[model samples]
Target: MSDTPQSVSSHTALDQLRQLIQQQAAQQPLPGERELAERFAVGRREIRRALNVLEEEGRIWRKQGKGTFVGPAAPVQPLMLHDLPQRSNLLEVMEARIQLEPGLARLAALRASGEQIALMKRLLERMQLIALKDGDQHELWDSAFHRAIAEAAGNRLMLGLFDAVDAVRREPGWQHLRELARTADRLHSYDDHHRRLVEYIASRQPQEAATAMREHLLVLQQTLIEAINCGEEEQL
Candidate 1:
């Protein structure tokens, strides 16, 4: 049977909506259905249909009371170690990342979809551009790139743990240390690490991905330690 006009329109709307979602930051809320309908010049039914398709693909998630958001829904339970960040120092946070993130990269190599790999590429490019044009925003994009890999690993529990450690890394003192550690030479090295890590994941080489991530984190840890020691010496 020939496809109905409405069904065809809905399919087109679905493609449009997917592109729109790709342009948005992960975890960003989607506009309401009515707003989306207006924006896409489609009926509300068509908008709902497109949203349903996206939800099934894990591109968007809707909460009954809170509207829709980009990316897969997060685990409902918060991390139990709410006070851990306050008590932690930069070294501790690096320790946690070195332990956790390589596993994420390995899993991502094993599990990431083609679309997810493409997103990682886009994020890497964005991070590089930010490093050149807007140095301060580099950390923000860098975090997003790593979070994308963690999400692609398809482990909610591990992602929750990642978020916990990430929260600690975001503390003002930790951010300062990280900023201090990011000399131009180190930034260039980081860019190389990011490229190799993404390539390994894209090529489905789990061990290589894991090794690249571990090496990258170890370098970051060493640099941060140096930054902290330098700060102490200057104060003495």
Candidate 2:
């Protein structure tokens, strides 16, 4: 706890602070930086770094006029752009998503509220109908559905990660590939896949939910790559 984030090889202070916050009375604002620094036997810089980590992970949020407080387990907002320049790195974006989203699904399995699950179910049903209309609104809800799952995972950081990934997902090229990938059969499967993922979350099976999401993303990745290659072939 005496070390700065640079001096420390691990996030010990961050973990300690996170656990300490959990021990406090629910919904209570944590003490200011100076008090937490004194209590943890760490510098204020280390305490601030730990607080940033907690904030990103969705465990906490700070109000500008007020103090830091715990965020809702299921946040209402769907996205936050991380201010990164957009690039044509569609595969790389999908790679990052595969790495993060399954873990969120796992957390949702353990923590999702019934209301969150119900929202997901409604989104799934709507996506099926919207898919038939062939509109961008469906894709918007596609991102929303995933954001809802991330919120239900009960982690603030995952929501941020999903937000960054989703902002890139809105890029024109990626959107084109997504539309191309949605064949009649694949779109049908998409509904089914969404249903299965929600079912695992509803049933409270973490591993199963993770597996369901991982498999779904893998299929999506393959579809995107195939679409990209096909477009290249057509150009030649």
Candidate 3:
């Protein structure tokens, strides 16, 4: 179901250690996970995952609950990697957001400051208040909520990437589409999702936070796409 954290951790020791394992491992079995972890100066989790990667690639085999051994290499399983897209179209923007934000939320769950999470909670409260009263402040608070999550990620690059997408998201036409999609009828659901995202991040459950963020964006993406296809005068 939720596999985002493993994917997130795959980059660090997974790549370097994998290459080392492939190059060094030949006819002999490799060192146990503890030895590998000490040699690599990484956590057992990283070494374990690196071994899992090799096993998946058919470059290594694990004997039930025992040691891992080298095997003839097979076709590699392509690792999931990403870079921000240059396109600013709605579909492209949404796709980019989907790719980056969930991971960012995962990072935030691991690293977010208490103060930052509190700020996000305040922003969520503001949105609820705006929902109650007929007002234009909802958009501002919504934007703040996302930016807060980006800040909570504690990665400058992640923050910058989020800011870039958010800038495009503020474009008048994009704003209009979002307004159309995020209608009064669907606002409560949106609020609930946002609440869940904040709670997960605050609770420090990386996979749950990532999944929550992914689900939230997917709903937004679907709503926005439908609105774009239907035109402004139409209500969905």
Local distance difference test values of all predictions, in order: 0.77, 0.72, 0.68
Q: Which residue segments of model 2 deviate by more than 4 Å?
A: 1-88
Q: TM per model?
A: 0.69, 0.65, 0.60
Q: What C-alpha RMSD separates each model from the true structure?
A: 13.0, 13.3, 17.6
lDDT at 114 for candidate 2? 88
Give the clashing residue pairs of candidate 2, or none: 56-157, 57-156, 57-157, 58-156, 58-157
Off by over 4 Å in 1: 1-72, 75-82
Considering summed lDDT, which 10 consecutive residues are worst modelled in model 2? 1-10
Instruction: For candidate 2, write residues 111-157 as lDDT tens digits.
Output: 99988898788778768877756344355456667877888898886
The TM-score that candidate 3 achieves is 0.60
Question: Which ranking of candidates, highest TM-score first?
Answer: 1, 2, 3
Q: List the residue pairs that clash in candidate 3.
A: none
